[model samples]
Target: MANAISASPTSTDPGRIGVAVIDQDGKRPVQISAQFAVAADSSTRFQIVVSDLTDATEEVALFFCGPIRDGLDLEEVNQGPLVLSQAPNSPARYDSVLGDRSECSYTTSRLEPGHQTIVVGQSRYSFLARTGANVLYTVPGVRTVLTREDLGGETMAPLDPASTVSITMAGLPNDLQIAAAVPQLPDSGLPSWSYEVGGQPRVPGEYRVMGHLVTVENRAQATVFFAGAFVGISGAAVLWLIEILVTGALGGRPRGEPADRWEQTKERPPPRS
Candidate 1:
């Protein structure tokens, strides 16, 4: 497809147009109409805008597909069509205020320079407050050792507390590391690990590890304080798409670079009805 190229406007091929989903609410997601255009040598752009803005963490996601057809909605097609499982990777310019646990993530999939996929995703955050008296304590500043679990996209759900799982912990303080020895599973069924990152050892966020399940002992219950800013988690999407077009036309790289599929590929569930 790269062989056919020329300076004439009519000489270029209008490669497969793409679909874009825009999330204006950053909580709920909506799909925008598809767009198509011919690339100078295989360049095109599509923008999916959100019509609603009731949420503060509004974001967008983009997905690429072979072509739009009525059957496109029939099944989770994983064929040749590249399925960018997450949002774009560019730093998100949050036009709204950020609260605790509020985060914006983008995928690094770069659809063909001119040919690309566009989808929009939004983020919403909700926190759970346990029934307890609020207490604050100050301590002498001490160097804190911390351990971080990157998880690398490992799903924490559906894990058995009785079973052992391996989680990757990064950004560790030189003095501390995940005890290579098998750590004991909490009687509550949640897995816990300890390590020091920095700061006073007792400070929160000092030691962190991704556990399959962090069950409270003898409670026979699970408490998740972090609800996904599930606002509107979208698939491979583009942000400020208009800026992208302007930048490209002004003699910038025709399109953003594609990300390694190994990283973009995610543990996606089957499409829902």
Candidate 2:
């Protein structure tokens, strides 16, 4: 069977890309390890599929935070609609939802929060685009090992500190960055996906959450497209006005000079409920 593709954004290429979140013990989401390659002049797109594996319905929103240097704040960037309804009829189930809400990118909504959504179940996310091209780099054999070392010494000895180690990915675009947040806590010493799908715990003791990027996928480039669309609409409107002016279709004296935008466009009074 074909692997189920989750919420992902449109790519510059023709094929579909996927984001897989492996949830063991039905807990916090873990993005799987992936590798990407780009030719010198070629460009690519990425989509992040975030699978919500709960039977009960809930409102879901995606937030981006940071390494302090990345400077991403959830409130400033989340201007567009973020809430998606979790129901049988919601339309996000389809793939390749595209468009930019702001500096962050997203395509379509794949809201399929249901009981059947299980291991290998996916939800797609997006990567911020640079200029001509970028690579979605993935690594092989490397797993995020998260370990909590217990101080097994007597009271007299100092307690051993548990270090949270995260394996980092290198060779990405300089402007790109990563932010991770956990949705749940670890249970037994094993990851749930390994036990349920692979029939054994992948790690005997420790594990780390792999760090990856969901690119902005080029806000400036996307703006060019939006500009083209706006110009097309404006051109059509201008043409219509000229026809009215030449054919005497306005049927009245010309209104005073077009109100300068500096003159507040007359505010419409609020509508009564």
Candidate 3:
């Protein structure tokens, strides 16, 4: 069996639902429809179904993005084509007013799969509380690859090992890029490491990575945040924001140049892992 994770429903608050389908073969984007029936005691039962027209294996992720009240119970029944699993929610610290949120995912196997459609018919017993609206974001497929190779032998050693990591996002309206400190390889010849993007090596120190999604009309910006590490008695909060240009053009800067044009004070520390 494929590995799976599950989470206990955390709240009874009426919540909004968001769903996205991920096709590994990059062939199909499934259409999803949801139905809700309110029960007595101010609870609701939600039924979400996905229609998969292609043969490729699919993964469906759901996010309960809401400012609803606390406590929800999610029961999965009649799972048509998907094997249900729940992964921890990604940080949504942007919305401070909302309390804790719920996020989960389900997967379908390439073999022994359903014929045409997958159903996630689950009942969510939630409380009737008016807080705010919850919206859903869909990511068709996300690809991540990480590889490492050792460079030392029994007698002779070069230094630290080399690593290659990449993250690919598909079905996104705009292109997204990410950069960060490569994992530290043990006792390497090089004192520090240089970050690379598109095969170009960047400066040798900690950098605030930035990515811009440019379109014909507007550009969207994203900044990479680094969590701080403690060295001794006192620790410093390392935070920086890279200005995303509307044109989505990235200018080449010399090594050791500041990645951010201006500095930003540390907001809330990067959401706790």
The best candidate by TM-score is 3
Model 2 lDDT tens row, 48-131 = 223334432122222111111022211112233333221121123222121111222212222353422111111222222222
- Reference-based lDDT, residue 200, model 2: 14
**Residue 80 alpha-carbon offset, candidate 1, angstroms:** 28
What is the C-alpha lDDT profile of model 3 across 35-128, one tens digit per residue? 4332222433444444454544344444443322123344334433343444332345232211233433323322225533333333334322
Candidate 1 regions with alpha-carbon error over 4 angstroms: 1-34, 38-41, 66-273
TM-scores for candidates 1 onward, in order: 0.17, 0.24, 0.29
lDDT of 2 at 128: 27
Error of 3 at 238 (Å): 84
User: Which parts of model 2 are misplaced by more than 4 Å?
Assistant: 1-136, 142-168, 179-201, 204-229, 232-252, 257-273
Q: Between candidates 1 and 2, which one is better according to TM-score? A: 2
For each candidate, the alpha-carbon lDDT, in order, equals: 0.23, 0.26, 0.29
Q: Which ten residues in a row have the lowest lDDT in candidate 3?
A: 151-160
Residue 36 shift from truth in candidate 2, angstroms? 11
